[model samples]
Target: MENNRAALILAADNSPLQVGPGPDQSSPAADEVVIKVAAVAINPSEWKMKEFSYIPLKYPHVLGSDVAGTVVKVGEEVKRFKAGDRVIGHCLGLVYGGAKHGGFQNFTTLREAVTAPIPDAASFQDAVVLPLGISTAAAGLFDDLKLQLPSANVNDDKPRDEAVLVWGAASSMGSIAVQLAVAAGYSVITTASAKNQDYARALTGGKHIAAFDYQSPSVVGDIVDHIRSAKGVKLVGAYDCVGFESSTRACAEVLHELNGGGVLPSVLVPPEASSLPAGIKAHIVNAAAPGMVAGSPGAAVWREYVPRALANGSLRMRPEPEIVGTGLDRIEEALNLHKAGVSAKKLVVLL
Candidate 1:
């Protein structure tokens, strides 16, 4: 636990991420593992958190969520992983708040519940794309949207005739949401830019997934009509991965168009309450809300489902990471690019 380094934000809001020596690594506590971070991915939340200071921080915060690395140490109570295990995990610096838990650092402490072993064939760069994207999508599709749990074995498959709307299917979170919903046996109708239609279609997991250009003027009507007219299928719910006002409202409108009411649409960002349609329930999904509890839905994902799915190839690192550069020094630039907006791609930095 010496000489480890990290990228730190010295001040709360109005600051840049700085590369420098970080605190010495600490011995893992029960239920925790320490990792030598091999790769990290940038998410919009990190930049927003740095700018807005929305989530509580203890000044000099470290902000990152997605991480892929090799295990350096494991705690006394840990049984699932050991030293030298290759893993992908969701670091909790954004929620837990510190450099030790942050992904920007050379060494990070990961809760066993939120960490999973990566397949030998997958690279850290590709695996790093899964942590946050998978967590957010799983939280929405499996918990909030209440879709059927995904299965790796085709023999145990159950068929369903419901359709799900994945607005912003080109975004990292949306791409995974589409895959998860399709794996759960629902027909997926999703929106992306005209350019990303092929990318979205590729992730449909051999299930029925329809891609529409969200920028088209008739997107709403087109989605509504498609879902409404699809033979023998009912619109069960939607997941608005881009939770901006327009996307959120579009989800509600589609649900309302399909059925008068009683449909749920889970969103990443909380949409304005005033803009939500009456009787159509829209809820904000906090991917980290499952909070390390043993029996929680988040636990099931990180502990059980993610590991099996990753091994079986049922879950994938989607939209692919566009390597920004190497080293912690490149994180700020990568994050700025992410904040500026990217389509059908995730920004990644190898450490």
Candidate 2:
């Protein structure tokens, strides 16, 4: 049914996803563009929401975020896209609340602010990885951490005397954070497992000031000493992409020792308040918030920066895509695999 005009629907909390009728062909809002979704990328939130009903959601809803495909139609107020345009968008079914905006369906509506045209070099499968990963990264880097925004022109960068710490840089969201920070001309300090250390560094084109092995017991000391004694570059803040207690604690402690205190934006939940180091704090970031509002940092990145960066090859679809299967039924298998855990790659389902 995903091949036709059908949806992968969730009937109730903790229920299995069922292939069913797609959303009705309704008139899109002035800023919305409907797409024939060619590919959808899986995120941890999708599986978690279904298994635990973690987020407030209506039953019989569709859940997904990352989408890449051809624009089938656009509303009157949408000037950037026309039918047949190849594009990628962050679907907010989870946020806007319903099946219509969900990416798991064959066709879905996405806001123009969060949608960007894809270049010929970026395939549907490849570009699908960008929407949520890059959105979350932009949200954390710009809105949450209040760092300088990224420029579409990489050469326009004036290197800053600061570095950002991105824990778990090989994950979907963290990888983009590393690249976006470098794109904004800030040197990055990243940590990943040995298998992903090189991957994380390459995301920033080796612009990283230092990279660390998360498995090493000396990692905290290593990060501290490197940031402290470096000839230049101060630590502005840290981003905990892993969201585990250990990752958040490590980042909080590093910020406490180096910067006296700092804000940390996490992918999921932050550490308990009682466990945080003095003067250090962490907050969870929401990628959908920026897209919902016009002229936001997230909107600008999605509108101007994404298309340009993707066209010029400054942004590579990283952690890479691990194609799990094709079609609606295979989505469940993909979800299971994503739940099992992946490293240095994203799970994608082709429709």
Candidate 3:
């Protein structure tokens, strides 16, 4: 009977998540699979959505986006996965507006197109960090910025001359972005605090990555100088994972210096379009949007890259999971901790 379980439910805007009777476990649809969730990662978007109520949602909505679990059911049309497969999936709760699509519940329905098989070596806690972070990073780099798709094989040859700047290198998204860009054969220059420089470099897996201190007053100049010093490299642009106006403006300033006056920057949060500098194109990316669409670059991340990368060790389960507590009861505690802020790590709950 425990399979018929309770979920950490969000009753209203700014309300604390309360455990309540979860929706009746539903059968998977064509191209869908149902999972018995083993772990779920906490993301900042969950708290922001709970407070702002920006995305349209019904009362007592479920809030979570990253799920890692064992597949319990598969739609007849599903081909890549079967019942009992271990997987990591991106939940479509905010995009689809349904509790069935959310990850806070014990059982969740995932689109087969947006689910990836996990390697046996990875734990649910480790794999849970992949879904949302991978989605956010891949969306910015591949979808909005149009960087070349990464291969599962690492390029051991000389690093390519293309360079990408990832602002906030220690955040979950920033760490993954650095790995992804480096895997795609671009030299990655990223910003973290002084403490995380080594950690950021570790995420790049011995690839061409340079980590700098974002707190320094001359951070922008540091990036510009790095670009200038690298001979024959074109600034492919930057991904601003921090997404505040200050971070966005700093990214734009780095680009302005990189181009001697202008460049386009891809941002994770929606930006005030008017605030951008001349010739600076700001692409505000919604990482969740790709999972909702078929054949989208964001969808390909889960469908193709994540599974292969995980198996081949090209994609890492990173920033690493800092498990707050166990069980559905701890969801609220994890959410508060996430809202309070964490450094260079992801908050997670093992269900």
- Badly placed stretches (over 4 Å) of model 2 are 1-7, 156-158
Which 10-residue window in model 3 sums to the lowest lDDT? Answer: 261-270
lDDT by residue (163-207, candidate 2, tens digit) is 899898888988888888888878788898998777877786676
lDDT per residue for candidate 3 within 68-163, as digits (tens), equals 999988888988988789999988878774877889988888877778999888999998987877777888888778888777786657778889
Candidate 2 structure, TM-score to reference: 0.96
* TM-scores of all candidate predictions against the true structure: 0.94, 0.96, 0.95
Per-residue alpha-carbon lDDT of candidate 1 for residues 298-320, written as tens digits (9 for 90 to 100):
56767777788889887878879
Off by over 4 Å in 1: 155-158, 262-268, 290-294
Clash pairs, candidate 3, are none
Q: Backbone collision count in every prediction?
A: 0, 0, 0
Best by TM-score: 2
> Which residue pairs clash within candidate 2?
none
